[model samples]
Structure formats: structure tokens, C-alpha cells
Target: MGRKHLEEITLLRGLAIIGVVAIHSHPPPLSLGFLGLNKLYIEELSKFSVPLFIFISGLVLTFRYTGETIVYTDFLKRRFEKILIPYLAWSGIYLLYRYLYKSETFSLFAIAKKFLIGSAYFHLYYVFLILQFYLLFPLFLRLIQRFKNRKTALLSIAAALNLIFIAFYESTLLIPERLPRRIFIFWIFYFILGAVIGGDLKNNKRSAADKISYKLLIPLFAASLIYLLAPAGLPLGSKLDVFWLMKKTFFYAALFILLSYKLASESNFPTHNIALKPITSLGKYSLGIYLAHLIILEPLSTIILNRNLLFILTLSIAWFFTKTVSNLPYGHLLVGKINNSDT
Candidate 1:
């Protein structure tokens, strides 16, 4: 049997990529307090993009390959071909850009170090972090299967471990000097949650919209907003400060995943609605857009000062670039997989 394609997942990808661009395109500080607040809101809200992507990775991987006997070598080979190649390609491009425009000098040692650690660019660290998950996926899969009957307990343990790790890191600052935030421990909970959801969906074949209530969405949104903004006013060392911004980000990531599944359950979501074509297209070409956006944004930022306009331009240009490349030979290596089906 073929894998079922979920339009909602694609929609979530589209939304997440937009959020990613928004994070990178947030306006520079201005003298106005309102503008500062807007910047803070954008930055805070968009922080969920990376986590959402991570969640989607776990969900899709587990949903597709749960029962199958995966060969570790084959899996790693596929991932390296699809993801790592593009990462290297883009990392080299960014490095060259820095050398030419920013006048950054690098020795052979430095270049190798940058590639090893994903320090070639600010955003590329995510690729490094995700690669670690891919490497450890077999162990994670084994553990998940072993504890399949106790999923709730497993998830609770994962969540607790994540929070404990965050608290320890916050207190000791013991993150690896080379990798920094690229560590997998900081992100395991989202991946585990996604894997559990994927398993549930696969085994039950139920609509997520039916499982998750719509009424809870508004409350989640309100709570997320309040949590995000509250820290700005609350004094340091408050409860909110315990996890810092991570608490709110975790809340928002889960809420966004629920929202995506709910919307995807709609009958006319992407297929029947013409207005959603652009967004679905964004989802289709998300990897390419993601890899190429910062390249486009760097130059565009100088010319276009408006944050909203800059985001639009970066997204539009990156989408077009990805679309054009996806039609060429071996383009998938550069952009990850492209869903060629019409929206």
C-alpha cells in the first residue's frame, strides 16, 4: 500500500516556512515603543517555526516508517543525499558570500570546523541539529516501540527530561562550546510528541480534527499570547523566568501542530480552495525556500527596509527560485523532496 498524503501537513509546512522568514525579516529597532513591541511579538511568535519543522519531521518519519524494518545505512544514505548535500551546497554559498561581501577570511581548518559545527551561517545550525536526530533515530525508534503500551508515560518522561535539561542548561551554561543550541537534548520532546501522534494516526486512522476539539484553540491562543507578552513586564526570577522563552515556545508549538491538523481535516482546505494555492505551493517547495531564503534576504534587506515587504519579497523570490530549480535535473538534491502534484 502507498502512503497517504495529508494536505494538512503540507499546509503546516507552508505556514511554518512563512514564520521562519518572519523571524529572519523582523525589523531593526526603532525609537518607538510600539514598534519595539511589534518586533518582540514577531520574534517570539515566529520562534515556533523551527520546533514545528522538527515536529513535522518526527511525525512524517514515524507515520511512514513505523512498522517497516529500516536499514540504518540505507536510511542514513538517503538522508545524506537528500538533506546533507543541500546543506553543504548552501553552506558553501553562504561562506563564499561572506568572503566576498563581509570580507571574512577563513583557513582550511576554519572551513572544515564551520562545516562540522554548522556555523557557516546562523540558521544552518538547525540542519546540524536535525542531522543528529536522524543519526539517533534508530535508538529512538527502538525505545518508542519498546514502550509503545505506555505512550503517555513515555511522553511525560520525555517532557520532564526536556524541562530538566533546559533548567540545568540555564543554570550551568554547560552547552557544548562548538555546537551551542544545536544539541538534540533540547528538542527531543517535540520529536517524541510528534512520533506518538504519528503512531496514533497510523494505527487508528482517525481524523485529528475529531480528536482535538476546536473550542480549545482559542484558549490556547490566548494563553500563548499572554505567556509570550507577560515576560516583558514581569520581574526577573519569576516563574515565567524558570524556562525563560522556552516555556512559551513549547506551548505555541503544540498549539500550532493541533491547529494544523484541525485545518487539514477540512474537506476543502487545499484542494478545493483556490485562494490557498500560494500557501500550499509554499509548503511543497518549503525546503528549497528555506535553504535559499537567507541568501535572498541578505541582499534584499539592504534595499527593502520594511519588514513586511522584505518578508514577502524574500518568500516570493525563494519560492520562484525553488520552483524553477525543481524542474531541472538533480534539483531535488538541492531542495530536498519536491511534491510535484498540483495544489
Candidate 2:
């Protein structure tokens, strides 16, 4: 079979990038009035954003073949070259900024420690998690592909395991707090969703009836509604139960995957134009955009916390600058060399 064209993947990449941008554009729960509404918005949107990213990562890898048998050494080398190298370089850049200008003084060891811990910034946490996912992906893909004919069973198992992990294991492990990076337990499901969906899409034996079910729009709308209601539904009067919220979010992630797949499967989306040029470029240099946006977002958020005009202006200006620099010849190379080589 021929390799799938790269156009849709580019668009999906754009969606993933925009989701991240949108997530950071919204303020945290504590900062918003009618905390429940804004919190629901942030929690729901942000939940979909990173999982979409992880799903895209796995989807891309599952579809592309390098010809040679997958080897952990080569995998690690390429993964590190793509993700970690850029991360480390950018961490140094940010560290230097903090050292010279910000109130904080950065020691070399402190810089190294922060980089390793992924606590240097909010987005860097993703960098650290992707590194972990990259190392395990080959094995993960191998195991997932084994269930090609048993997809329903496989999905059931994944759902069950996810519930168990979320309810039972995560707190005991305290993985996110203790680890070098923030470990989002739900993202593992996203990664698997990407792998499984991509696998089914690639499989030849599946009939047209199967594809029709994939087209239903109900799941997307339902998931969005559930996500919106969760905070309001479980308020402190009624403290919004975190456990129940997470459980619903897991369902939300699945619906998101369905939505993403449906969107990607479409041939009608706009594929050209000037206004979209920046976003399309963002898709191409997403890793750079992902890492570089935070450099602007954090401070901008501080400066424009409650001012609506300033907030919109900040997001627009930052998006422009981020897209501009991400597309530059050497700028792309520098960050691309480290965090993403897929483009």
C-alpha cells in the first residue's frame, strides 16, 4: 500500500498547536470570576489539548515506517535528538534570561536541575513527558498492533486499565509531584487511542460500515456537554469532586479522539490561504511553537490577567511573534533539532 499523503497530518498538527495556544490563552481557575464556569472551560479545553498532542505523536509514528527494524538504541537516539536536545538548549536560553534580567538568580546546577525536572516552566513538563513516551513508544506500538482483530476487546481493556490507574495507582505513585515532569495519567490513554485509531485506519479488512460509525458527530457534542457540566455539577456546595471530574474527562478524551479522527477524515477543510499561513506554519514547526509560546504566554498572562482587551491583544501579538520566529530558517532548525524532527 502507498503511504498516506502528509496534508491531513499537517492540518491535525495545526489543530494540536492551536489547542495548546487556546489552552494558555485562558487563565487558571483561581483567577476567573464565577470560578466554576471558567474552570470548566479551562479544564475541558486543556484536557483535550495535551492528549491531542500525545495522540498525534503516536499516530504519526504508527503510520510512518523507517524500513529498518525498530531498535531501542536508534529510537532513543532519534527521539533525544528531536525532543530533548532542543529542550535542553531552550532551557539554557530561558535560564540565561532569568539569570540576567528576572529577580531569580540561576546557578548552572539549578538550571540543569530545572531542565531535568521540567519545572522550569509549564510547557516544559510536556517536553519531559514526550521524552518518556518516545522511549516506550516502540514497545507500546508493538503491543497495540498485536490486537488488530481484537480492537473492541483491546479498547475495553484500555478503558478498564485507565480507570484502575486513575483511581488506584496515581495517588500512591505521586508520579506527577515526585517525578522530574508533571505526569498526566490520562494522556497515556490518549497515546493509546491514537495508536489504536491509526491502526484501524491503516487496516484493510475493515468494511465501509465501520467507517460510517466513525462519522457520527454525537460523541463530540456529548463529550463537550459533559465536560462543561462537570464543574457546575459538582460544585463545593457540592465541592466539584476531582475524582468524578477526572473520570468524566477520560470519556471526554475518547470523544475528542473520535472528533479528531472525524475531522482528519474529512476532505472539505480549507487547505490554503494567507490568514491561515501562520497557523499552517505553526503546524509545520509545532514543537518550536509549543516550546517558544510559553516564553511569551507566562509573562503575558501575568500582565493581562483580568483585562479583556489586553488579554486578546497579548494572545494575538504573541501568536504572530511565535509564528514569525518559528518559521525563520535558523530558528526552526535550532528548536527543530531538539524538540521535533517530524516536520
Candidate 3:
């Protein structure tokens, strides 16, 4: 039988996309003191968004195909169709936008370089990063299977390596300055953790309740809150510090995964409530929103003075565009797969 649909995962996706938008929407200046601190808090908390998405990718992929024989070619073809094609389309769109408005010149070689490196837009690097993971997933799967009995050890090792890489990346010691941030090693721990959890959920048929507990939740919540309220000088520097930002985000992402699972397991949790409809809908069209939002936000920023209003308008426009395009012939090639059942 097919695995049950995960409404909680969709809910988490909705939350993640909101976080993504929050990070991009520039808030008031730090001179505003309390208001600035509030905005900074939200933005800092949202740092978990990207890592959470990466974790979900690993989880959903493993959950669906753990014990099955995956035809590697077919897998690549599907992933290419769903992800890479849209990435290329968006790259071209962004390139044209820059050439027309920003007076940026692009030669054939430059365009090709942008496509290869995901430099067409700031957000496109994530697509490039995910594509890298997709390409190496088969090898990762085999490795996971080879040591299936020692998942905890595998996760521990991956986390240690990830932390070490982050430290090296920050110090610029062994890692080359030219090495791109899109490298998989920088983010592999979250994916591997997700894969291990996915495998357990599949092999053991464990309920969401079994995957989380109050003992876990209480401590994670305390840690996250403490991290949020603590002054910038304490270890994790200002938000501008990439190393500390990523380190904290990794912690937040793990906490979120557990929290989401716990919420989904509750008997009275209202997945179909009217208040939640928009969030779940946003989750449904998250990829399209991710691709389209920056394009909309850049143009709209000139007209919308209020940052909050700009955020809402950008999300609304992107959602409308995504929903409209998803119905057109071969729209997935432009925006991404929109069908809720596909996930």
C-alpha cells in the first residue's frame, strides 16, 4: 500500500515558505531599536527555512523509495523535468529582467556560466544546490542501505563532519575561497538525518507520536528561545555572520521538524480549519512562490512603501501567478509541479 499522506509536512512547507519570504523582505533599520529587534527576531528565526526544505526533500524522497528498486535514469529524468527545467526557465527570465532594467550585459558565455553556477539570481543557488543532491542521491541511498543498522552512528558522523566543514568554511583554512556555498557537504547532515528518519518511519511504520516527545520538545523550545533572546555578542555574532547563522539555523531546523511531527500527531489538530487553509495552500504552491516572489518583490518594492504590505502583496501575486500557470499546458516546466498529490 502507498504511504499515508503527510498533512503535517505540507503544513511545515507552508511555514517554511513564509520564512523564506520573511528573510527576503527587508525590515526597518536597526536604529528603530525595539521595532528593529522584533523584525530581526523574526528574520533570524526564519533562517531555518532553507535547511528545513532540504530536510524535507531528503525525508520525502526516502519515505517513498527506501526499500524499492529505483531506476536511476528514470529518477533523474523526473527530477530534471520537475526541477531543472523550471530552474533554467527562471534563470532566463531573471537574465532578461536584469538586461532590460538593470543595464547588465550578458554574452553567450556569461549566460552559460550563470546557468551552470546559478548566478542568474540570488535565490537560484538553492535550486543548484538541490540539483546537486538529486544527482548524488543514488550513491547516498546505497550508502544508507549498506549501513542501515547503524543509522544513529551515521547521523552522528554526518553531523560532526558538517560542523567541522562549517568551522573550516568560516576560517577559510583548508576550503578554497572559490568554493561555492552550494556544495552538498555544507548541508549534508540535515539531509542524512531526514533520510534516516524517513527510513525509520517507513521500515517501522512508526506513528508521529512515537517520533516526538515532551521530553524532547521542552528542551528544544528552551534552547531556541534562549538563542533568540540572547544578545548578538554571545558566540553567534550578528545576523551578518554566515557561520553562526547557519549553525543556529541547523539547530532550529531540527527543533522545527520535531515540533511539526508532534503537532501533526495530535488527535484534535485541525488540518482543515479555515484559518489554516491559506497556509496549506501556500505550501501546495511553495516552489512556484519561491521562484516568482523575488521577481515580483523587486518590481513592487518601488511602489509599496510599507514592508509588511509589500510582503503580503508579493505573496498574493506570486500565489496567483503560480495557481494560474499550474493549469496551463506544461506549466510545471515554468513554475514547478503544483499538484498536491505529487508530493
- Candidates in order: C-alpha RMSD to true structure: 3.5, 4.2, 3.0
Model 3 clashing residue pairs (backbone): none
- Give the TM-score of each candidate: 0.89, 0.79, 0.89
Relative to the unseen true structure, what is the C-alpha lDDT of residue 335 in candidate 1, on a scale of 0 to 100? 81
Number of the predicted model whose lDDT against the real structure is largest? 1
- Candidate 2's TM-score reads 0.79
Rank list by lDDT = 1, 3, 2
Q: Candidate 3 has what TM-score?
A: 0.89
Error of 3 at 85 (Å): 1.0
Candidate 2 lDDT over 1-343, as tens digits, reads 5235435555666767777776666544543357546654754555666666777777667655323377778878866776777687777767766766586786778777898877576567788788777877777777776876776777678778777766653345444333422564545667776666655545533422235464365755575666556455444332223322255566776676666656555544444646555555557666776777766766766667553444355445655665576567765444564222232
Q: lDDT of each structure? A: 0.76, 0.61, 0.75
Assess the local accuracy of residue 257 in candidate 2 as a C-alpha lDDT between 0 and 100: 60
Q: Model 3, 1-343: lDDT tens per residue?
A: 4355556666667877888888777553454366666666766667778877887787777777788899999998988888888899999999999989899998999899999988899788889899888999888888778768877688889888887876666655455433546788888987887677667666765633355678978788679767654644333343233332355556666677667656754543445768788987888889999998999998898888777788788888998999899999999889899735224
| After superposition, candidate 1 runs with Cα above 4 Å error | 1-3, 27-32, 172-180, 205-210, 233-245, 266-268, 339-343
User: Model 2 scores what on Cα lDDT?
Assistant: 0.61
Candidate closer to the true structure by lDDT (higher is better), 1 or 2: 1
